[model samples]
Target: MAEWVERVDEQDEVLAVVDRAEAIRRRWLHRVATIVCRDRAGRILVHRRPDNMSRFAGQFNWMLGGATEAGESYEEAAARELSEELGVRGQPRFVLKFRCAGVVSPYWMGLHEVVVEDQVRPDPSEVAWHAWLTERELADLVRHEAFIPDAREAYDRYWATAANSKRP
Candidate 1:
């Protein structure tokens, strides 16, 4: 079955519903909702994509999420993606949203954060490897490893916002 997504405008208003593949082919803006998972110790969960898949296959990512299906809000998409990718559930708190000038396709990215206390059962087709890492370790990997481009942008923005929140 063909996957569907809402093509969105610069203001993030919906333009139309289209097939995901067509949206990619046309470089139409859409919504992709993601969640950054952290453990109780404040370590972030990172994962490597399987080598066999397309679009940034074999790259590392700190966020787990995907295209928002038609009529799905960003929060709903984030929650669904969390369950689909990690087999763990939690209420994802909204963090930020931005337009990602993607390597594959441009889209508005809605980012959320969740603390996962349950054991993560990763879907092998989506995650080849998974680990919990300190902020320092993840930052080091971001500097040295092959990471997904759009997610790297989100990571930087996520932390920037986090740092800003600490200001007086």
Candidate 2:
């Protein structure tokens, strides 16, 4: 089955609906929704992708997400991804968005934040390994581990935005 996605312009205005592979192959802009999952104690949920996956295989990522379906809002996509990938559901709060100079392909990434207080049943195909880590530990892994490039960029941007918002 083909994964269809909306190919958009720099501002993320839809130009056409195309296959995800074609969009990636052409480096066409598309929208991806991602969620930063955290526990009540504020530990981030980090997962490693399965080696069998086509993109970013065996890479670590702090966000659980995928390309948004045609006409789907970022919030909807984030919610769907949370359920599909981690068997957990909660209202994902919109945090930030930016155009990523992607390692694989360029795309508009909408980053959301959600707290998972329930037990997570990760799908093995989507997540090969999972752990909740402190912010300092996650920063260490991001600096030293084989994390996904796009996600690393997003993580930096997310924290940058958070820091800016906390200023007087």
Candidate 3:
């Protein structure tokens, strides 16, 4: 089983330490990633995490991503997750980072984006459903609290930066 590490609440300046294995087994202090993909129409791809997931099960979320391995770079972790969870190959662009505080399981999240033309084959164990949505649609979902809270800020950041960039 993978081990977990005690996470520092950087914003709150709180310090605590716990057994890594116990933390993960107990669903505490997880590290995760968010993958953002867009089509020619400028619609973003989102997916629902499998209900079997330990936290936020069945939650509508961004594309293929997950926890980072020990000593793995965030970029490498993102790429691996993109291929593993979505069965697609492409380089991922690092975009944003956020922390979600939980009573028992705080999460540190990394966000990445990639543009691709290949079809997606989501891993059933990881993803339950997926959809393509425009920025406006995503914003509406955020307004209604339909998406994962930890990912909303990253999504918004991606949307803003993507809109400003000249690259399609």
In model 3, what are the clashing residue pairs, if there are any?
4-20
Q: Which ten residues in a row have the lowest lDDT in candidate 1?
A: 143-152
Model 3 lDDT tens row, 18-58: 45556555665546666788776778887888888877888
What TM-score fits each model? 0.97, 0.97, 0.74
What are the runs in model 3 whose C-alpha is more than 4 Å off? 3-21, 24-30, 102-104, 157-168
Q: Write the per-residue lDDT of candidate 2 for residues 36-111, one digit (tens) a residue.
A: 9999999999999999999889999999999999989999999999999999988899998899989889999999
Q: Evaluate all candidate structures by whole-model CA lDDT and list the values in order.
A: 0.92, 0.93, 0.70
**Prediction RMSDs, each to the true structure:** 1.4, 1.5, 4.1
lDDT of 1 by residue, 1-168 (tens): 889999999999999999999999999999999999999999999999999988888999999999999999999999999999999888899999999999988999999999999999999999999999999999988865598878788888988998999921
lDDT measured at residue 110 in model 1 versus the true structure, 0 to 100: 96
Backbone Cα, N, C clashes tallied per candidate: 0, 0, 1
